[model samples]
Target chain A: MNIHLTDQPIDVAAVLASVQDEGAGAVNTFIGTVRNQSTGRRVVRLDYEAYDAMAVHQMRRVAEQAREKWPMLCQVAIIHRKGRLEIGDVAVVVAVSTPHRADSFAACQYIIDTIKQVVPIWKKEEYEDGSVWVAAHP
Target chain B: MKLKIALFGIAKEIVGSSQLELEAPERQSVADLIAQLRAQYPALNALTSFAVAVNSEYAPEDYCLRENDEIALIPPVSGG
Candidate 1:
């Protein structure tokens, strides 16, 4: 139950440790990075923002949903970074541990997907010539 | 009654403020608040979609808003 929206760089090892469990045989982790290019434009950087309190609340719901869906899950950790980010920087990390590999993988994917859909967080893409808020326009 | 609403992401940019206070008749619904906001800030209508959160949880359109409710304007989310 380690859900966090942090402003600092995410420590992958720390995130993994938070979900460590002796009963779990598999630990599935997903790390989302800021890619250098989006569409046809070369992204210079990205600015991430969150409605901090609501973001955390929604992330907790995502973890809860995962746990309910995957009874075998031992633990869950979701860490998302905010503020300025450069190309290749890690933006988010999702980790799930379970007795078997399949459950861990499924739960990890579900958590990340739900977070993107429900969390009150946003990222602004900065290209060489201009900037735009991702998903802002219809 | 007057209610204060929190703005985030593009909503904040569109309104040019992080928070705003608006006067509404008592027991107005969330949808009414949104309509009022759109009337005041037409730029909000340009977004793909948006949701209203009351006390950090997504509120239904028919949900009644109370004074001092921690309402937030949620623009289209793009988090990973």
Candidate 2:
């Protein structure tokens, strides 16, 4: 189980290594970082929160779905950061390895997409003037 | 029955607490819980949408909540 939710910065190299396999021909990785601006606001930092137990459970579910869809996938690693993060800080990483290149790419993308939709995690954007929970309002 | 609703992100800020205690009937559904909560914390109604989770899984509107079941008010998630 490579899924993790930590307050510390994500170890991208470790995540990539977690999916290493001799038979795997491709390892695909998706890294999400905090941006300097959002919707034209100069973002200062982001505060992330999560329902710890449920977030991990949802991430695992997403991983399982990806594996079921791409049986050739050898391994999967998903890591999400919590607490405060500055611009350019890594927020999440999804790495996948497979016997071929296509499955690895597809599974990695699928895992991140599903995690965003289903995972019980939230991020608040802070600007110089005010802050808001991203996507909290229509 | 007594229910403790866990709040997160904006929901927590609106309620000014991470957890809340509510007194409800034994047969309260998820929808009933939401209505009660929104009335108590009107700011929650302003959010685009929210979800209810029972014991860590998303619960349907009509899902009946039981005692000792973990319940949470989930604001719109923005994780990447």
DockQ of each: 0.88, 0.87
| Residue A43 C-alpha lDDT in model 1 | 99
Which one wins on DockQ?
1
- The TM-scores, chain A only, for the candidates as listed are 0.98, 0.98
For candidate 2, the per-residue lDDT at A54 reads 96
Q: Write the per-residue lDDT of candidate 1 for residues A71-134, one digit (tens) a residue.
A: 8899899999999999999999999999999898889989988998999999999999999899
Tens digit per residue, CA lDDT, model 2, A1-138? 499999998989999999999989999999999999989999999999999999999999999999889988889999999999999999999999999998887888899989999899999999999999998988
lDDT of each: 0.93, 0.93
In model 1, which regions exceed 4 Å deviation? Answer: none
Candidate 2 lDDT: 0.93
By summed lDDT, the worst window of 10 consecutive residues in model 2 chain B runs over B36-45
lDDT of 1 by residue, B31-77 (tens): 99889888889999989999999999999999999997899999999
Model number 1 iRMSD: 0.7
lDDT tens per residue, model 2, B1-80 = 99998999999999999999999999899999999988988988999999999988999999999889999999999898
lDDT of 2 at B40: 87
